[model samples]
Target: MSQSNALIIPGLKVALVPCPALGDTTLLLRLAWRLQAAGACVTVASVSLASVRSYLPGLNIVGGAPDVVALAASNDLVICAIDWQVTVPLSNVAYLAGKKLPRGFNPEQPPVLLAGRVIAGAHNVICRDPKAGKTMVQWIDLYAEEVLGLDTSLPVTGLQDLPAVAEDADRRVAIFPTTPHASKNFSSSGFRRLARCLTARGWLVEFVGIPAEQQKLKAEYPGCTVRTFTDLKGLVDFLSNCAVVISNDSGGGHLGSLLGLRTFTITRRRGDFTWRPGFNELNRVINPILSFKWMGRTVWRPFIPLRRIVRALADVKVQ
Candidate 1:
């Protein structure tokens, strides 16, 4: 808590609805931590409710799109992410805008119908399109300073503290080989290579994914432990005991980083650097070997070699 707590109104209750994605929801945890530190009671709602609750058990969490008007009435302030597509009034409500609208949501006419689909009439709107250039963390810092009257910088802290289960906790390493976007994932063979290397050194390697991905992961990494979590609490509890986590550019890396675990993120391109996990000092981003524009979009080819990833992991003395 580098910033002075005086800037925020003590005991002010706030309700927040973050964007739909798990990664997007986790990015707001920093802001929630700051608010809680200042004695402000914070409630967060997201599609990833179970995951959020697992990461920060201290905060009040609800599921799905809550009634904004009802929340605004109960809480002192309501901060809704613009991606929710809910029209809210300007009074006592602020909007946290994200990168853009959901994909494939285009109106026939920009001026007439666009106004209906977008979130407007908010007294304060942070992270709008003009502000999208900054990284999500940078946007949150700005929100704290300009909106909440906090210090320019603050020490990064996990929303909750998790104690290691036992002496063998450091011997465990969890690898997440899946991402919502297929292109963003590191190669399956690459993860297998890294897992085998770690296993040879007596490090216990495990693979985690959703229930839908469980069978595929088990088949891909035979002879290795594959644990599928129906609930995020189970997944997070499992991760808390692990020493390190390796993941593609997805929610798993973000969750591990939020839990203060050493995380290695495999990103598809250098451009995705802005979205890399950053809460923990041990967090690192691994990018592809080369990237070039193919058609209208950039194509990141041939994920980074296994040797380089291994070298990066070795750089950190995780014990």
Candidate 2:
């Protein structure tokens, strides 16, 4: 097909099936922007309502493979953000019948199998090393300009349109203190201590989480302010106006960094660190100083001290 002809296909549609987690969806959102810039209409397809809302505003939620196939039939390009193993059968069947199925995020080299049929491969923007993370972000920015044919003049304020706390009060601090898993959760006692320390430092701490988590944090933290956020807008608003954010290795930490907030993240050694957010120089990561294997197991042998986290927080600069 001619380049202009491909660009003018009236029914050309691109579908992005984001991973189950909110962070993955957020990454996919960046890709969606690039795809849209490439002249393909993009729609995010997912199963989680909250996940869909967090990353994709007008998502097409699907219940099963049949629904996905139906959606794929009408589209010219489909990017599977979910694990390739789960979607390989559907992708193969679709491709055999002349549909485009582009694979996403393999650690190895890009496959030559669907050459020309695939719009882009997933390995282009993923990184595990901290230094490479910055490179990956830069590559994505370039991809948006070069491959996607987008202008380089667009503003790159990450998540700036989302709702946030109303004011930048000097005394307010946003404490994003929850994780999706128990292993990543800091000790409640440690959190209470941290809250009291921030309060003593004249910072009014607000705990942000889902509704149920807000209730739990309130019961645990007593005097701390608790806010239950329903959408990405609300979360962004809260993070944007906060003085600083102390969170686990969850979506909150990523959101905090994206909003230019000073962020401190507490993560277990075993948690995935490949996609950690880069907040210029204001973000800190605290993990147990133990062997890699020790951190990977669910239970730990207490290789690191809580004092290290306290010291790290103490060293943070408000600016």
Candidate 3:
């Protein structure tokens, strides 16, 4: 289609369906920001309310197939995150019937012949992150730029923007203690040790996590301040106020990096280094030793001492 034709479509809408998790939802929100910049009205559709809240502000939200179809009809383009496999058939039908541009992977890239009138495998249009081979963030940025014709460099809105820092706080430290999988979680024992160390140094530590997880941690660390919020807004609010963030390989680390907070990420292995966040000064990734066999080959690992983590945090230059 011609660029003008694509740009002028009335009610241009893009749907972002995210995995029912805070991290994935955050990635989708970034994509929404890009889409909005590109001139497309973006709606983040998900069955999970938590996921929707985690999305960046200013994007539309839809909960079911019926609404998704109705929304797609009026908009010229519909970009669905691959996580919405349950409602793919309905979405495909809507795109075919409405002649809307459909973007995103479907059933592992189905054959064009069997995929029917819908745009099969348009999901690949959004490039995956080279590190982890996941398209979550890259795709969001791509959809916004390529499909929406929006400028990617415009200051990212929503959670990426931080509140002004408090002048009186002795020190601001962001604590991220959650990970999607056990393997990536920084040891709670190690975290408690670090927390105690920071507290002893008179730094104000802010523990950030999903609401439920934060509540649990608050109960555990009665004296510490823990902000358990599911959405990016609350998370950013806390991160913005912090001078440094110590995180595992989770959404918190990503947010810290994006918001210009100095982020120190603890990883279990180098392979987990994918998506460590760009801009070297704002983000530092520290990998601990772990042995694992890859493709039937044994690999030895080297450990990263706790002293190293502390030193890295000390060296961070807060902007």
lDDT of each: 0.69, 0.55, 0.57
Candidate 3 shows a clash count of 4
Give lDDT tens digits, candidate 3, residues 91-120: 332111011224553434442221233434
What lDDT, from 0 to 1, does candidate 3 have?
Answer: 0.57
Candidate 1: lDDT of 164? 51
Stretches off by above 4 angstroms in model 2 are: 1-12, 46-66, 83-165, 169-171, 270-272, 279-281, 289-319
The list of candidate 3 runs beyond 4 A from truth reads 5-11, 46-58, 61-67, 87-121, 125-155, 158-164, 168-170, 210-223, 230-233, 278-281, 289-302, 316-319
* Local lDDT at 317 for model 2: 51
Q: Which candidate is the best by lDDT?
A: 1
Query: How well is each residue in 95-150 modelled by candidate 2, as lDDT tens digits?
Result: 11001224543423333122244333333334324444352334445545553445
lDDT of 1 at 241: 88
Ranking by lDDT: 1, 3, 2
Tens digits of lDDT, candidate 1, 224-293:
9999877666777788888788988887887788777888887764533667676667777777677787
Better of 1 and 2 by TM-score: 1
Candidate 2's error at 315, in angstroms?
8.3
True-vs-predicted CA distance for residue 139, candidate 1, Å: 2.8
